[model samples]
Target: MGVCTSQNEAEKIENSEQDYQKLDFNRVSTYQKLENIANNIAAQQQIDTIFSSLIQRMIASRQSHILDMLEKMDSKKKQQFMTKLERIDFEFIDSLFHHCYKQDYPDVFSCNVVQSINSQEQNLDLIKKHKVGIVFLCGGRSSRLYDKLLSDIGLPSKKCVVQIMMERLKKVIMIASDNQEIVDYPIAIVLSDQNSEKFQMYLKGKRDFGFQSITFIFEKSLPVIDMKGQVVFEQENQAVMTPEGTGTIFLQLNSFINKFPNMEYIHFLGLDNLAGLPLDPQMLNLICKQKGDALCKVIETNSILDDRIFYFAKQFQTIKDQAKGIQENSQNLGQMCLNDLYLSVSFLNTLKQNHEKALKLNQRYHTIRRGNNIQFEKHIQDIIEVTDITILHQTDDFALLIDDARKAVIQLSNVHKRNLKLEGTQEKDLVEITPQMSYCRREDLKKIENATYPLII
Candidate 1:
C-alpha cells in the first residue's frame, strides 16, 4: 500500500509540471504574435529602428515572464497554455528580421569615381569623354502654379517659366564651349504616371534643348485606400493621390548609376524656380575643388517670410541597440543647425550617413534575432564642410544680364512711364512708383544713348 501511494504521488507531480510548462508556452506565443504584428506595421511605415527595439524588448522578456507564470498555474490550466503556445510559430521572429532588413547589406563600391562634380566646361568635356547621367525630379503636382509648366506670365513674348529656364541653360552651355557632343549625357526626367504622357508629348516636338539623350522614368502611384480597403478618391473619375515624397529618388539613383558606369556627377533642380542662375563653370569648379560627392544650390532668405522660400535642413537620429551591450538611445547625428544657409554637401552627407546607418542596424538586428548575437556597433559618418554659394540675387546684374533681362526690361518700361510729364493735375502715385522711378529718371539721360546715324552728304 505504501509503495502504491508513492507511485501515485510521483505521477501527479510529473503531470503538474507538464501542465505548468504548457501554460507558460501559451503566454509566450500570444506575446510573440502581438510583437510580429507590430513589426509588420513598422516595416510598412519605414519605422525601422523603432521596430527593431520593440522586437528585442519583447523577446528578452518572454522567457522570464513564461517561467514565472508556470510557477502559479494549476496542472489543467498549464496544459491549456501549452496548447496555445503550440499555435505560435517560433520561426516567425526569424522571418520578421529578414523582411525588415532586406537590402541592409552594403554594396561594393566598384566604380572608379564614386562621386565627381564637373563645371559646365569640365562637364562638357566629361560627357564627351565618358557616359554621363542626369536625373530631373518632376514628381510634384501643379498645385501652386495651376499645373502648367508653360503658362504665360503676361510677358510680351509670352515666354513661360520652363521655356525661359531652358533658353538660359542653352545660352550658358553655348558660352561654355562650341562642342555639340556635350549633349550626350543621359537625362532622366522622373515624372509620375499621371503626368508622364503629357510631359512626353511636351518634349516630343521640342528638339533644341541640346540634350543628346533623354529618358523619362515614371514613379508608381499607390491608391489612397481607407481602413475598409475602399478607395478614398472613388468619386473622382481619375485617381486622386499624393506624390510619394522625394525619398523615392534614392531608389531610381541605382539605375542611373548602372547605366552610366563612368558617371562623374548629377545635377538636380526644381521645375518652377525659373529664376535659377546659369550653370556657371565657376560654381562647378568650386564643387570639383572640394571633391564633393553631392552639391545643392542655396539662396539666402532674409526674413521670416523668406524662410518658406528655402528648403529647411533635416535632423536625423543615431540609434544603437542596448540589449547587446550597445547604446540604444537616439543622438543628434550631425552639426549644429544654422539659419539663412542653404542645403549643401554637408546636408547631403548627413542624409547618406542616415541611410547607411539604418542599413547597418537592420542587418545587425536581423542576425541577432536569428539566435546569432554578433555585436555590430552603429556609427554615423561625419560630414565635411564644402563650398556653399549664396544664389546671387535676381537683380544682381551678373545673373540678371544672363537670365532675368526680360524682367529687368519690364521694370525699366514702368520707370520710363513714371518719369513722363502728364497734363492732368493729380497727386502723383509716388508711393507706388517713388523709389524705382526716382532712381531711374535721375540716371536715364546719362545712361541711355542712341547709335549715331550716318549723315547724308
Candidate 2:
C-alpha cells in the first residue's frame, strides 16, 4: 500500500510539472502578437457575450505558453514561428475546433447533408420517388470460417454466405416493390483489397439476385508485421486493416451524394448476416416516418449476460485546447455513454433529439489480455441512427417492458417470447483471401490468354 501510494504521488507531481511547463510563456515569440489579435477580435464581437468571454478566457490561459516559446527561440526561429502563427486564422480554427476542454458540445453531430426538415416534409412525394442506398461493410477477414468470402458453406448446392445474404436481400427488394411509398435502392458491397478478386468471381455474370444495382468498392487494407520484419501471416503479406470504424461509412457516402444528392436515407448492414432475418424494410420505413436521422435495430435478450446489446450513456471529459491555450477547467467530453443508456425505442428517440453532432456507429472486435493470454470477442449492436432517422426498436413482447416499449408487439400464444431477432446469421462461406490473389490474377490471366492466342497468330 505504501509503495502504491508513493507511485500515485509521483504521478501527480509529474503531471503538475508538465502543466507548469505548459504555463511557461517565455519560449514563444508571437505570443504577445497573437494575444493582442485575439483580444482585438474579442473586442469587435457582434456575437454572443458568452462567446466573447469564452474567447477571452482561452487567450489568457494560452498567453503563458506563447511567451515561454518566444523567449527560448533565436531571432531566425522567432521569425519563422511568427509566419506560422499568421496562417492560424482565429475564426476559421474556432469553427473546426471542438472545445474538448469544456465538453460544451453535445454527443451527436449532424451534418446539413439533407436540406431541411420542412423541405423534406414539403417534398415527401419527391423524396419517396428515390430508392435508399444499401451499403454493406464486408471488408474483414473470415478468420472464423477459414476461407474467403466466396467459399462454399457446408450446405447443399454449396452456396457461400455472401450469396445467401445477397439472395435474402433480393427477397426484401421484391417485397419493397408493392409499397409505392418507398423507392428501390441498389446494394453496394464494400470489399477490401484482399478479397476483391474472389468476390468478383463469385459475383460475375450472376445477376439473378434481383438487386436493382450491384456494385463493389474497395476498403483500403494495411499489412501487419512483427518486430523482426517478418510478415504476421503469409496470406496477409501486403494486406491492410479495415477502415477506422463503421463511422467511415459517412465519409464513403460523400462520393455518391452529388449524383444522388436527393437521397434522404441510407440503409447499412453487415456483410456476415447470411440469414438476413431481422432487417425489415417496413421497420426501416417506419423509422423514416418518425424523422430519425439514424435508426438502430435492437433485440431484447432474456440472459443479461449476452454481450451483443449495448446500453448507451453520456461520457464527460475536460480537455485542454492547445490551439487557444485555454484549459477551461473540467467539462463534459460528451460521448454516447455505452454502459449506462438503456435499450429501448425511447432511448433511440432521445439520441435522435441530439442527432446533429452525434455519430451512430459500432465497434466490431475488442482485444483483451488475461495474464499471459489474449482474447477477442464481437461487440455487435443493432441499428445506429446517424441523423434524425427514427429508430424502431421492434421487439416480440410488449408486456415484458410495458413502461418503455413504444413499438413492441404482443403475441396471442401464451409461450413467452421476449427477444426480437436483431442480427442476421453470418454466412461461413466467405473466405479470407490473401493479397497475392489480387496481384496474381491480373498478371497471370493476361499471360495465359496471350500465350494461347499467339500460336493461332
Candidate 3:
C-alpha cells in the first residue's frame, strides 16, 4: 500500500512539471535562445577565434569584406545570410563571386554633394613646390585584352599602358615646372600578381619613361575558388588568380610612404584614363594646408541624360513619362572630374590603421561571367568615404582629359586651352564615345573664383 502511494506521488510531480512547461513554452524557448546567444558571445570573447573552413575562406577573401558584410547585416539578416551561405554549393558561389575586383562599375561610388570652394591658385603652387610623388594603379590581369585580341605583329607586344602612363606624367612635370622644379621624383607603380614579374622585366633598363625612379609595389593575388570549392586552374601549374584592389594601397601605404621620406604628398590615379593631373599642385597645397587629412578633386560632368538630350530624351519626352529627380541625377556622372587625391604621410598612417573601414569606401563590386571574369575595383573617387572630403571642382588652370569619339581611330592627341588637355584612348580600346557624350574641359578658374561660374560639389 505504501509503495503504491509513492508511485502515485511521483506521477503527479511529473505531470505537474509537464503542465507548467506547456503553459510557458514560448518563454522556455526565449530563455534557451538567450542562453545560446550568451554562449556565442563567450566563445567569441576567447583569446583566439576558433578556425573553421569558412573563417579560413573569409581570411583568404580579405578579412575586411567579411567583417564589413557582418557589420552591415543586422542580427536576423546575418543569421539568415550566414546560414544560407554555409552550404557547400552556396558557400562556393559566395566565394567565387566574392567582390575582389569588378570593372564595369555601373553602380559604384557616391557621396553627399556639398557646396564647393573656389579654385585656390596658392594651394596649387604650394603643393607643386613640395615635389609631390605619383603612384599609378596599373596592375590589370591583361587576360581580357589577350582574349579579345591576339598578338598584333611580333609576339603581340605588352600593351603600351606603361608607356602611355609615363608620357602623361611627363606632361604633368612640365606643367608643374618650367620643365625644372618638380624634376627627379620616383613614380611608384602598384603591380598585380600577374604583372609584377613582367613589369620588372620590361622596366629593367627603361629610363625613357622620365620618372627619376619607378617603384613597383606588388599586390597579393589569390586563387579563384569555384562553386565546388576546388581551385580553378588557369594553366598547368598556375591557378586562376586576381589582384587585391585599393585595399592593397591602404594596407601598404604607410610602408611605401616611409620609403620616400622626402615626399610630402602622394598623388594617386588609376590606369583607366589619363584625364586628371598626375600631380595636381593646387590639390596638394589644399591637402597640405587643410585641417583635414585628404582632398578629392572633381569636375562638373554632363549626365547621360545631358548626352541623350540631343538624341533620345527629346524622343522619350513625347511620351507622358518623366524620369524622377533621383533617376535623372544618376545619369550625370562627374566624368569631367579626375579625382586628384593628395594624402599626407600622417594621413597615410591613419588610413593604414583604419584601412579595413576606409577601404570599404572603395567597395564597389560588379559580378561578371560564370566564374573566370568576376572583377572588383575601387576608384579614387571613393576616398570621401574615409575622410573629411573638401570638394574642388574643375578650374581653368586644371587640365581636363576627355575620351574622344570612337567613330574614327584616334592616336593619342592633345588640346591646349587655358590648361593643358589630353584625350583619346589606346588604339586597342573596345569602346568609343560620341562628341555629345564627351567630358567638357573647363578653363575658367578666374570665372569660378569670381563667382561668375558657381562651384558645384
Instruction: Tell me how far the alpha carbon of residue 131 in candidate 1 is from the true structure, in angstroms, after superposition.
Output: 7.0
What are the runs in model 2 whose C-alpha is more than 4 Å off? Answer: 1-128, 155-158, 178-184, 208-212, 223-244, 277-279, 302-457
**Over 4 Å off, model 1:** 1-133, 177-183, 208-210, 222-234, 237-239, 302-309, 313-355, 358-457
Q: What's the TM-score of every candidate structure? A: 0.44, 0.41, 0.51
lDDT of 3 by residue, 1-457 (tens): 0123322333322112232233332554433333332333324433112223343343333321333344544555655544533432324334445433222234433443322334454443533454467787666565534311112211112334455456556655655555674455657887776777766776674654545566777776544555423445443223456664554565566666776677766777754443344665556655555444555554453444211001111111111113312122233344344435555566656665785856575454333343434433434445554554433334433222223222112211222212222223233432211122122234431221222111121
- Model 1 compared with the native: what TM-score? 0.44
lDDT of 1: 0.38
**What overall lDDT goes with each candidate model?**
0.38, 0.36, 0.43
Candidate 3 regions exceeding 4 Å error are 1-131, 146-161, 174-186, 208-212, 225-231, 235-237, 285-292, 297-340, 352-373, 376-381, 390-457
lDDT of 1 by residue, 1-457 (tens): 0123322333322112233234343555534434444454335334443434343333432322332343555655645544443333334333333442333553211111111223323344533444333455566455334545655654444555456555555554544455354455556776876677777666675763666667666654433323222223323122234343333454465566566666555555444343343343444554556544434443233323211123222222222324434331113122122211112323343445586643542332211111222111111111212212222111211111112434433433343333343122222211112221222223343332331211000
Better of 2 and 3 by lDDT: 3
Which sequence of candidate numbers ranks them by TM-score, best first? 3, 1, 2
Could you tell me the C-alpha RMSD of candidate 1 in Å? 17.9
- Model 2, span 376-407: residue lDDT tens: 23222323333232232423311121111111
Q: Which of the numbered candidates is closest to the native, going by highest lDDT?
A: 3
lDDT value, candidate 2, whole model: 0.36
Which pairs of residues collide in model 1?
A: 19-78, 22-82, 183-212
